[model samples]
Target: MSSSIPPSVKPGGHTPHDHDDAEHLKALGYASEFKRDMSAWANFSLGFTYLSPVVGVYTLFAYALATGGPPMIWSFLLVGLGQFTVALVFSEVVAQFPVAGGVYPWARRLWGRRYAWMTGWVYLVALLVTIASVVYGAGPYIASTLGFEANVNTTIMCALGLLALATVINLLGTKVLAVAAMVGFTAEIVGALAVGVWLLITHREHSLGVLFDSFGTGTGGGYLWVFAAAALIGVYQYYGFEACGDVAEEVPDPGRLIPKAMRRTIYIGGAAATFVCLALVLSVSDIPAVISGEDPDPVSTVLNDAFGATGAKVVLGIVLLSFLSCAMSLQAAASRLAYSYGRDGMIIGSALLRRFSPTRRVPPYALILAAVVPAAIVIGSKISTDAITKIISFAALGIYIGFQMVVVAALRARLKGWVPSGKYTLGRWGLPVNVAALIYGIVAIVNMAWPRTPDAPWYDNWIVALSGLVVIGAGLVYMIVHPLHDRSSGPYADAVPENRTKA
Candidate 1:
């Protein structure tokens, strides 16, 4: 019993939707275009594009500031290790059911379809809200680069322009998205390396003493908890890696390539992200200044200081590439996630939203719809960039919930001795890794949700709370609708659950 269809009278037939998926898979190159040769690199690059700078710059700064000084660097390293364990668990689920829906489908099989629909609806709500966050997150960087005036209109216009560009890029499909990510990957690596070099060469006087000694600058008492929570907020950047798995059907060799691509992405992209984290910690003279409210572009400030405005410009270019790459990557993932939802009949206009372009083999309708939601948020421009950062942080937080659910399901199977087949393996380390991922997730979520104090009205707390409400609302709607439409095979299907791999 997969997640997509509820446990009731199961309907089996050669429906048009079935034919459509098979053909859609063929047209998109998932049927053949995605050979193992390129999948690993492309997926890793995609993951890097999404995780490297977007989430990194926005929330991690809060973590560094709220936590200690350079010790924040170690927080990220800890989070990364925990996330890696979760990623491995997901890889096995993916390898078992290498379809487009990913975890929701797994939920259907293990839990039941009614539950799966509720969960998928929750995921869809998270996805749509995240679109708004991305636009909000990137707006300030573009605005602050040349140092825009006090004119709010000018800032609004500049942010709008970024949204327009990202939306357009998204319309072009994953082939274009992948190419842009590759470019982003190049810029990200080069920029981080360049920044690291400049920091070491010029800011040599800063030293480890400053890095280590700067932690106690904040108010004492529950400060350690606040700091950890804030860092968890920052760690959200590395999310969306699972997007690669969701769009597995659109790739070339899903069974052989999708899991491989996903795992390799964790390995490679994780390394790059670690470098960026380490560079920022090592480079800045004043740790608090970077993530603090002052400098909008902390890394750029370091570059500008190290090599002058020219150097800052160089880093700015990289950050822009990083943001755009992330936007493009996000657009692809969001669209694919929508398509997966449609396949499960969760969204309105499911048939239309899930339509594939006959020529390109891509989900043009879903992608187009995906762009509209985010662009509309950007158009309003009411949500501050910091607010958007919180949203992505919250999105990362939501993903952990999904991770925990899957881990519980997998662990349940393990306890029952009902082992499944898949590509990702945890060796003798499975139980320990699962426990660690759970702990890491719980810590990050608490860190993310913790308010600045008892009276603060921080956007992170608000957006996260609102997003949770949206999930609840979606579940209620899904439940009402399911009773009317269900021909259930279970309560949930892991997400249109059929097993992980078709090959």
Candidate 2:
């Protein structure tokens, strides 16, 4: 699990932990610029918070239930399994290249700079839009709980406010971000458990078998298609586990710790989300009515039915906290991505974006850029309220696109005789799992991005697919016009650690 330190940077006066971390980083061709303030728990908390069950489930719950009925709940387990496969590949990659840029860095090391740039570009956009989506999702819940009119202006303002709060937390440095994430994690767990238990005990209205019942309302290529669309909720929820890898530089012994943090984030987050979804499904009073639009907002309706306005409001408040925490983690992850790209002089204004504040040991400019793009997205979403759904879909699709690029890269690397190193390894099962992960990523991307709304305009139906193409196309154009010298092959080539031959 430990990387060999290059003789030049070997520990003399530095503590063993700091020396190990510093040398590990130096061998990877980066300075220990920021404070490695996050512990393993904080690392896991950031990932868990980024994959916030409250935000993901509550935001998309009604859509899934309406689109695919009760059976859609099973999509959580299915997507969780698929994503776990991807997580396995990512864990192995991160163990060796435990740097700031998550998918981007992994892709670059495995493939090259052009591939990494695109992965970073798609992921950066996804993370930014995700911040906007999380904040916008929080608005109505916040408004309803606080008795404010949940209008466009109010929602936009609320989103902006939350984005601002997240920005401030990121600006405060790793310790504060870690603390906020931990608090958010604790709150979400407690709140999910409290509401889930209450609902199951007092309001259970359906059999456990209901989750398998499709209710015979299949459309748009029958049950599987509807199920695929419903899987968006699960797909979105299962991601952000890589946020642990994104902030790997901030974690001590990242090669060993980050992989564990990533897996734990998925396991714990997936379980909590499933429990909540199950309780909500079993608590539904009338599934037919919910699917028929009689209860357009089944999640809120169920909460209000189980516990009066006051109780619902309390739960909504916890959900709002979850939303904010999710935004905070998204911004932090995105900023690290920016910093990573900028560090190698890959992006424009690399000097400023890569600069770490001496006092706070944070990338202030990168944080600002992260907040700015999402704030712009929020502003745009407000202009067309209907755009919120499409934007969220597109964002999730972008993330998957970036993820599969890494999966594809891993497969290519494996075929080229690459071997994984560090504490974690799939061993003989690696090829099958990698191939399965690759297949799942491709299938999921097509399923999620395929136009489900045939009646809608072409652009509306194809927003996810179109957005992904545009992002990738734009990145390509930019790269062609302003090509980057591959850092990994240049003077700054990462030193090959003596013990790191397995990679």
TM-score of each: 0.81, 0.93
Clash numbers, per candidate: 51, 0
Q: Best candidate, TM-score-wise?
A: 2
Whole-model lDDT, candidate 1? 0.61
Candidate 1, 96-199: lDDT as tens digits: 56666666666655555565565565665566566656556556666767677524466566656766677677666566666667778788777766766666
Where does candidate 1 have its weakest 10-residue lDDT segment? 29-38
Query: Which candidate ranks first by lDDT, i.e. highest?
Result: 2
Consecutive 10-residue window with the lowest summed lDDT within model 2: 490-499
**Tens digits of lDDT, candidate 2, 35-122:** 7789899999999999998888887888899889888888889999999999999999998888887988888887777878888999
lDDT of candidate 1 at residue 91, scale 0 to 100: 72
